[model samples]
Target: MGDHFFRKLWQGTAPLVLWASHFFFCYLYAASGCRRETWAVLLGATLLALAGAGWLAWKAWRGGGEASLGVLHMARLGGAILALAAIAWSAMPLLVFGRCG
Candidate 1:
């Protein structure tokens, strides 16, 4: 059950963890230069994070679906939602601001 511990943890919140990392890098890049390329990078990052969230949702539903993991399945779903919200929040600046002044 030792290795299974990490597996369960990842299955539980990988999407949300990835979202946190993505948010950090996106914000770091934007704050560094706010260049046009930064938005492109951010777009790519957001897409990747969203895709990860989708994968988490699909994984949780692959077998008996939510019935399989019960509370864990619900937690994964919650993580997916949070990931999407974080992605959206991180992306907003691209629409609202320009390169650093």
Candidate 2:
């Protein structure tokens, strides 16, 4: 927590946000019960899940894989990326249709 007191918070929250977004959107789409080539959306979700795991593994490898700290570090980073992507993807509807202010 020396140099990363707030840094880790940012890193950790990203994945949490992404995970939340994934579920939110997926459910939103599913609830509509409409069918129109869902592969793209499904693929995005799959990639995000895989990215989180990959990030953890990357940290483990970078840290020699002897300590659990590395694994955790990688996981947070992965979540951060996924979260960011989720946020971006979620915004598409807003951008296309414009949101009310």
Candidate 3:
């Protein structure tokens, strides 16, 4: 029971956590100094976050089963989707500005 609870907790929160971490890293990196490598770092972080969120969403979608688990999986799916959107949105400034301003 404890393991199951923890697993569910991870599934529901992991994507958001990844998104938040990526957001933090981007700002921190940009603030440190907009070096020539800044774009590369941001791009890498964005791709990694997107991949993580996508994988979580896929897992949530594929893990669906029993009625009781449906809600939990749905929550996981929703969180993953939200994270995906947030991460993409957060990366937009990099694309639009094309450099630290």
Listed in order, each prediction's TM-score against the native is 0.80, 0.45, 0.89
Query: Model 2: per-residue lDDT, tens digit, 23-92?
Result: 6866686566545545456557646655764564355346544544664566665565555565456546
Give each prediction's root-mean-square deviation over alpha carbons. Answer: 2.3, 9.7, 1.8
Per-residue lDDT over 2-101 for candidate 3, one digit per residue giving the tens place of the 0 to 100 score: 9999987887788889999999999998889978888888999999899999999888787777743677777888999999999999999889989644
Ranking by lDDT: 3, 1, 2
Question: Which parts of model 2 are misplaced by more than 4 Å?
Answer: 1-4, 60-101
Instruction: Name the runs in model 3 displaced over 4 angstroms.
Output: none
Kindly report which residue pairs in candidate 1 clash with one another: none
TM-score ranking from best to worst? 3, 1, 2
Clash pairs detected, candidate 3: none
| lDDT (Cα, tens digit) per residue for candidate 1, span 1-87 | 889888878878788888888888887877687565776777788788778777776776663444765777777777777777877
